[model samples]
Target: MTSPPQPAAGPVSPLNSPLEPESNRKLAMLLLAIVLYIGVLLLPTPAGLTPAGQVALGLLVLVVTLWISECVSPANSAVILTGAAVLGLMGKSLTPGARPMKSADALAAMLGGFSSTAVLLVAAALFLAVALKHTGLDRRVALLVMSRVGISPARLTLGAMIVGLVLALFIPSATARVGAVIPIMIGITAALGLPINSSLGATLMIVTAQACSIFNMGFKTGAAQNLISLDFMQKAFGRTVTWSEWFLTALPFTASMSVVLFLASLFLLRPQVPPAAEAEAKLRAQLAELGPLSGAEKRLIAVAVLLLVMWSTEGVLHPFDTTTTTQIGIALLLMPRIGVMHWSQAEKLVPWGTVVLFAASISLGTLLSKTGAAGWLAQQTLGQIGLSALPVVMVVGALSLFSIVLHLGFASATGLASTLIPIFIAFAQTLPVTKETAFGIVMIQSFVVSFGFILPTNAPQNMLCYATGAIRTKEFAKIGLVVTVAGLLLIMLLSATVWPMMGVL
Candidate 1:
């Protein structure tokens, strides 16, 4: 495909550079955070909130502000927020007349998230992703699919997307899926001699990132945020969300959105040049290089299929929980003789930052709900916006829009879920819908939180693709805006029609 025009060379003057002011900007963000903290603390406590809840709210504001401005990395922000939560609870306990929050209680409140089953599941899933990468199976599958689809650019893109959807079934994490796919797509660009700035290169990269995020919604384990939401639902309302239920509810939207993403990429980021006839031959040669599947590949494939079957049938089979199944799968992958990956290699590939972020977010979300902050804020905000007066469908649409817009201010989907899901659960209580209907609405909001297409920082996958420099921020924004709008409309349409029919609303 034809490449975009290269930027003209310019002097490397640091002071006059556009990014030169970032340090000052971060400093300003810190200052703004301090001011916001003070402002929230100074305001009279909202009705129905305890002192602890108000303190939590202040901390939430500071954390959200710092995260949006990126005064620090998201992992660091999560750590800082965790510390704030601890100190806030401790400070409340120190007050003479206040109920005593014991040191053990405070510690449990902050550290509990680290011990979550969801966190453990993510850790195990990362091992699977690492095995796929180390064994080169991910690339083999990509090339095999491309070879079968031939060399047409549109067909290649479609084939890549289909491969992504299939991977989502077994690979739980979107970040992991992106890691597996990007290098293979990059190699394709190199094989085709496409310029880094070529339309085809950018399209392939953007498509891979976008498709990963879209398919993440289709399965229960598609994203860590999904698990977090399910956990919250169980704790808040004693509701259990099964794999089949999640699949049936989310698959329709995910499938439709995937089509929308494919069409959008095809039209908005179509290759500028047609593929050369030799492209198919090159892909076949690459696939041929892999030769036959090794025993390791066969073993990993067997274990992955077993894990998928277990996850899909967990509710009916009455076997082990999803977390246990994952743990068992990890054990099989690490078996001495049959293992496809070594611990040292898998350890290196494990995303510790994501683990920490997930744990901290879970801790923060638990605190927000337990402290009554989520409920208080939900009530006040909804009342202020007259949300309680609107029809349930309108409220759902409003929340869908709010969820999408709020994502712009947060870099991590799990972080956004931790912040918004609790508030949504509380807000749902204020609606006129039945408890089941309210839960369905909350679930919809939770799904929307993963729709992080509007900004590169909205998802790690987006950031990974953007790091290649093939896709500019404006270029991403152009497609992101359209996809986001389409997504919002789809959520509304489902909420009004499909959800009610499915008894979700």
Candidate 2:
């Protein structure tokens, strides 16, 4: 759903350079990963770090290096990690001394990630995204929201963000939401005869992308990474965080950031010239051409609303969890009477690779936690730096800063979560705090996993929006860095006050 290339709003020469060939780069990165893995393996196992833990740490380094360098696709790289774990972690014991893990047992433990309901939930989300696209419901919703706004720059920018917030609920995949909603944004810029290269045009696209990231934390199903974080949190803390509960916790941060994002576009990245007075008319006209909702749209709406009710009422009106309810919702859509879309239709749009990658990532994180590698590594790093000795707010601040800087090297937040979340979960555990406070630390940091706010390459949706040629990497960074800092301060606020009040911090 990417718009065709539009006129670039800013200079690009600053970001371009000659680079090595792709195959050569892959070979170089793979070699670097192998070196790091062997380096870890050769390191004398520190006290309390068993042989198995050391091997797990080695595998973590190898896979992360590969992922960061794009040496291999994340799914295949995960497959490598799994195969390695099956062989590498079949040890005599998990602790200093214990019962031996049989080869079959090692294989089973390594594959637990694929068996997790989170994988199925992600697959279910893809199916739902496909069904929405098949019915064109997502695009209609976006346009309907856009149709309601006046043509002022402030109104148009706010309209784009509202579209993102609303679509984030209905369209679970961030890229899919951008695909459905942003072409309309581009069309509006085009219709206004505004070169996307202009300040107004570029900011419009950037905010559309940023808004997707903002609300990715707002809803449990907003992004795949959110589920990744949730999976880690539940495993570490052994408690469920229901859909409504997550919404209530995230509302203050997401809502405040939404307002900040709007203001930034208006004052910080002001358009060179105001859009034509006819912009709203064109938006409504495009929405009008879609005409009345189709039969499929109506049925899809009903199913969506029913699912929303079920999701909101979980633990209150019913015992069904999010994964179960989502599966039920998709099943209804595929059924004969409901008939939102055929399995064949969804099959075409559904991203099976994402499901594979997500499952594999979980396996990687699971290996880290189960083998005690994460805890030992946390002891080595966070403990070494005395982060645990800092004040509670300072601990959060330092962690947030670390997460932001680390995010510069990561392209996929899901990959970042799979790598760092387990360690942080262990970091929380090792903190000299109550079991509840430790759990709270993990919960609060999970929100930081959505911090793909500093680079165009940081997220799939950012890359998708960047393809429009409306925003240069440098220009995007200007807005992204500001949002990243603002988001960090907001998290600090929540951690200091609201999250603690809610027993989350």
Candidate 3:
């Protein structure tokens, strides 16, 4: 009656992984970056741009190549790109007819992102994720609700979507949210006696991962990249996007996509879940075992609701920006006796590399703008496309489709935003619209940066769920294509309608 031994797992496909940056590939990418850097420097500096701008453009290409290929660690690449900027271009002034740049002055612009509000918000958001993980409140919330959805295949799929939507508000880190939700989903799949790769299992996991991504567009704090985009916008235009405004700006689109994600998950993936009659009790029991929310859960929930309020009312009920409010909340969570967790425990759980990457992304994009490289590059590329001649709606569609295609090359949306948002900010400026509307155009494109649908490696959340071994790359890509198409169209539609009405188009 004993079962035979399971087969040894083979090598993981790169399509389903974050594609670790190591070996010959890493060296090759670095060499390519060098070739690109040298080539750009050798070319005649384009008209309307400074010699410093050309150097910055070369750095942009080289750094982007490293980031997308992930040939070097993000933090390392960030530092490398900035150092190269200061070292190579300190004598060249970015502004025509200005004093030649000094080392400290050039260095200051390169590191500007590290001091911005968006970077601090990103750090605080990670702390929020850590607190949830420390208290297991994230798991409890996910399981408690999902356990209630009947074991029907479609219902289970919808439950996953609902969990992702709810968690988007509570957990700012999409990767952390998926990490907490996917295993619970896999467990539910297992208790039903289904194989991990069952249509139902794969469908559930796919939707679980995509849901986390889809909702990242909804909240300003939902994704680290959103903060990065806001930082770029702030630096470029001196505008601030509040939590509630971001929510309202995004709600119609995110809401529509959420439904599209569900239909696509249910019908496209076609999860043929069987009636696992008994597993329902196992699901409920899992939630029950937590034994009536402990003291930590109580404190975490109370603080979370309050933080949610604080985040939502910024610029309306309070002048405290998202970063200030978030730091205040994190402070409460780290207090000795009254808090849910300690700095020692919370720090251990936080991904400090994210902070590095966030700061670096901001710095890279800021430097690109400061040196006029982003605008120059945009003029050479997007500018040639005659986007200004097209209606504002077409601008949305064009930039969105471009972002999706560019995302194929990127592993992190933060990197994508760094590489493109500045270019986008510049590109938007050329569009025949008011300055405010042009800023809105850049904000809209940032949402597309979150579209990590086509491949697992494209987003951290997608990769985390893919690691469960329940879904194949092709299956994930199948759904991603549908969502990508749908998301792009929705963005365009909103650009013409909702966004315009809000004066955001």
After superposing candidate 1 on the true structure, give the runs of residues whose Cα lies further than 4 Å from its correct spot: 1-35, 91-98, 273-275
Candidate 3 Cα errors over 4 Å, as ranges: 1-22
lDDT (0-100) at residue 18 of candidate 1? 85
Instruction: Please list the C-alpha lDDT of all candidates, in the order they appear.
Output: 0.82, 0.83, 0.86
TM-score of model number 1: 0.90
Report, for all candidates in order, the number of backbone clashes.
Answer: 0, 2, 0
- Give the per-residue lDDT digits (tens) of candidate 3, residues 321-420: 8889989988998898789988888788888878887887787787788778888889999999888899888888998999999899888888888888
All candidates: CA RMSD in angstroms? 6.4, 7.0, 5.6
**Alpha-carbon runs more than 4 Å astray in model 2:** 1-20, 90-103, 272-277
What does the lDDT read for residue 168 in candidate 3?
89
Best lDDT goes to which candidate? Answer: 3
* Model 2: per-residue Cα lDDT over 448-496, one tens digit each: 8788887998888999989989999988898888889898898888889
Which candidate comes out best when scored by TM-score?
3
Candidate 3 lDDT (Cα, whole model)?
Answer: 0.86
Clashing pairs in 3: none
